[model samples]
Target: MFFRLNMKLFMFFLAWAFALLASSLASAATVEQIFKVQNRTIKRLCNERVIVTVNGLFPGPTINVHEGDTVIVHVFNEAPYNITIHWHGVFQLFSGWADGPEYVTQCPISSGNNYTYKFKVQNQEGTLWWHAHASVLRATVHGAFIIHPRSGQFPFPKPYKQIPIILGDWYNAGVEDMEKALAAGGRPELSSSFTINGLPGDIFSCSQKGQNSETFKMKVKQGKTYMLRMVNAVLELHLFVTLANHNFTVVAVDATYTDPYVTDVIVIAPGQTLDALFTANQPIGSYYMVASPYKSGGKMFDNITSRGIVVYDHQYAQYSSSHLVMPSLPSLNPMMPFLPPFNDTPTAHKFYSNITSLVGAPHWVPVPLEVDEHMFITVGLNLQRCDPATVTNDTCKGPMNHTLSPSMNNESFVLPKGRGYSMLEAFFENMSGVYTTDFPSKPPVMFDFTNPDIRFDLNLIFAPKSTKVKKLKFNSTVEIVFQNTAFIHTDNHAMHLHGFNFHVLAQGFGNFDPTSDEAKFNLVNPQIRNTIGVPVGGWAVIRFQANNPGVWFVHCHVEHHTHRGFNMAFEVENGPTLSTSLTPPPADLPKC
Candidate 1:
């Protein structure tokens, strides 16, 4: 019956190379591609800045594959800095070597060097992506990874076309400069502009220190449905996206199929993706596709909308108009559609909580009934003492001569310096002293986590920095309650895992109560995702089966937070048999 409903789409795209995805269905394919990491002088927001990019494209080339195919990619680093590419949302079954994070899986592929990553995409089919895993490079070195199901396997409403919209930020300075500024324990510089498909749209002009960007446009025939796969690739900001007066039937998220959710606005955090289908049932003229920052507390910069135009083919116009209709969102910029206020928590919560996995569908994984390991991890910003007498003035930029650091379970994660081996390398070769498997399952102490008026506790303000990981048994069912705290201030945190997608059981504001929150868990059909944006000063719960044996990094997707020690890893022990264990590292793995 599912096949019967989606057969039209299956056959429609069987030969149609839509969205520039040139793939065949004779059999599962072996996709071979090369990514050249280099720097290019690009003019954006009235500045000619040298930005590091993959293949010189702001949003690099798309990697299109099917569900059961193998992917082999060679990344040659020509940029001046070290880099590593992460295949986000890919379940790296028996292929953890290719799960790239700077110090988790492998060291950085140094400049003038290259590394080969080989993996397979199995039992997953939808929108995923790849981006630079080190520092703020992901702002430019990212692209879409669309996985199409085999013929007759697609289960969704038939759409006439598919579109990939990559939402990002624009900065005048180079990414390294921004990293250096943030390393001083201060807030990073503000983004000059928000972008849609690499453009900040025409509303912004270089005369106002903004880029003269081309607005992305989607041309559609009247009455035809189109599927748009949207990715939030911003450095630290969450985005609120809407297509003027159109309604969307959201079908998938983070490569997982979901129950069709109809909504007008899309709230996407960093490192998240959404797929929605909309019909061109409106008038013949063009409409605005607007995106803006959905910031919930924190500093503000260039609070504006990144836009695109939705132009319908007027040849067969049913409701033709002489002039185009514009969206009615409240705008900071004149003649722009921008209604989503910076702190629209209710809308964001609705979009995040209402989504559920399309259970009983093909290739759906059921929620594990038994939990072998349960954890309560606190995610928050802490302060590290920076003395004027001992350290330079540059390092003491945080409040009260303290640098802004972050932590999980009150233990600030300090990744091992590239000292000849990554954590995975040390774990694989029995090299000791690099990392310890002692990450705690809960915070050391309890307090009013989200209270802003209470005097801050000195111990809570500073997490003892260390490199610690939680050890998990192979194939163990694990549950985690991620508590978001307000040490310095409360802000949304986008937590991402490396090798596996977890079931988002529940999310709420303030502290997490075990008894009451456990009752709210959606054990039947929770949304499965690799990344989740825990609410500001709130908490979220997730569960996953530690079936893959590897060293997987779990960190905040807001890259600057990861740099500030908001990260940890899981050392899942080897499975019982050879087939279930992690494969040996490749010969050309990068050496520190």
Candidate 2:
């Protein structure tokens, strides 16, 4: 009896040990995905057009992972052009090689080559996205990257369902051809149509005929809350979104949790994401959700509205029609769900200012108390003299044989060739001629930044091109006043930081007055984000700690502005400890 009892106890202990091992292995498993980029003909808006896509998925594939998971993506670029994928809003802590801005972090994956991006998602949980960082491929090569809370419980109440709504633009002309045309100093042509989940919704004229014509639709049950993760992937437009007869309580932005704020309309600029929760308490009916462009600079844009549908599941049963009757939805004309005016700066300002960080949240970081570095940068559109050899009567659009050239300060950034070395690699190797650390702390010349009549002098509007970066010591606190200049054109610009999310200290229209505006800074519980839109002809103050060591890209998120050279980089020195320093580059980093 004693021997039998001993054996039973030993077996129980062994089973417990095996169970613990299995759980540990499951938690530490790496999430890997293989993406194949190829050119395929896809039918959209009633026309068949060839587009570059990943794994033949129109909007690519949605990558869902929990927080603290290691994501490994092997991208095989079979397309005709080079490509690079940027995980937008991922902190990429100590892993700058995977931060995927061509030439800045790593070289672009060349045509017909493969590169593997491996990075761990640390301390971030919310909605983010990934998109092509090379040329204009992001139009179709984009998808949602949703990070669930690692603790298995969200900060707010769990919702009945979660959905991703990706807003994008469609261009009729070939994207590469468009880039070449702009390079030749021609006027920019706007996108032909806007899309929801790669579908130009039913409201579009071209979407009415094709057998595959589709619109994004969501069915909800009454009295249940749903979380919508909305991403603005449009290249050059700020979008105003509305859901008919419903209001949303915004829970987060750019993957950072925020105190709930309720609003009827949400204004999201390119590269911005919003996570909102709304209870389906309205009357049982179908409603139309709308997305329209909010033109800030009076520039011509695609004036059409993209539509999606939301229906109460029981509404079909209420109709009691054997013919599968469709519930009446609001008319698309005039957009029933009202939006603010196209240039309503006040509305946009209110939405941005009201979002305060949720203190004590899992990822909350307090605003830095003292700043070691302060930068006052001016970003806006400028002009440069067009080369006579490449200029023609049809090509030169700006005044005095010049063309549109956007810049940060007086220097328009030019990407370094680097001989196939990334900026971080070049810095660590002590290589010269890759990039300079003389990026100005303030604008070279300052005038009334909001003056509307400042475009008279062609020389003043011309910005010289260079690749400049700002260097900072490890663990330093940095503050920046991102002042938007109206020299050539006054428009809203969304600025994105690659490696960290900063606190939006304050933002307001007109020039940012140091004396008065200093008092308005929210030192406590300021909203944290990786991207914040500097208001049109206005300014924003942001603060962050340079704890992560590496080369980080700071630039306007608008693809047009970024392509036109409105960008700079930050080089942070390594800390005293190895754990705080940057890890060595992976063996499979892409070559130029």
Cα TM-score of candidate 2: 0.91
Which residue pairs show collisions in model 1?
A: 45-211
The window of 10 residues in a row where model 1 has the poorest summed lDDT is 327-336
The residue-by-residue lDDT of candidate 2 on 1-592, one tens digit each, is 9999999999999987886666455456678999999998987776788899999987889999877789999999999988999999998988888988899888999988999999998889999999998887888889999998765677889999999999998877776777776675535567878888887788777675446666777888867899999999998888988898899999999999999999998989899998999998776667878888887884566787788888777644333446554545423342257767778777787887889999999878888899999999998888877788756665577556777678888789888874667788887676887899999999988888888878556546889889999999999999999999887668899999999999999999889899999999999999999999999989999999998899999988887678878899999999999898888888888776
lDDT of 1: 0.85
Per-model C-alpha RMSD: 5.4, 5.4
TM-score of each: 0.91, 0.91
Q: Which whole-number lDDT from 0 to 100 does residue 592 have in model 2?
A: 68
Residue pair clashes in candidate 2: none
Off by over 4 Å in 2: 1-27, 209-211, 315-335, 387-390, 393-395
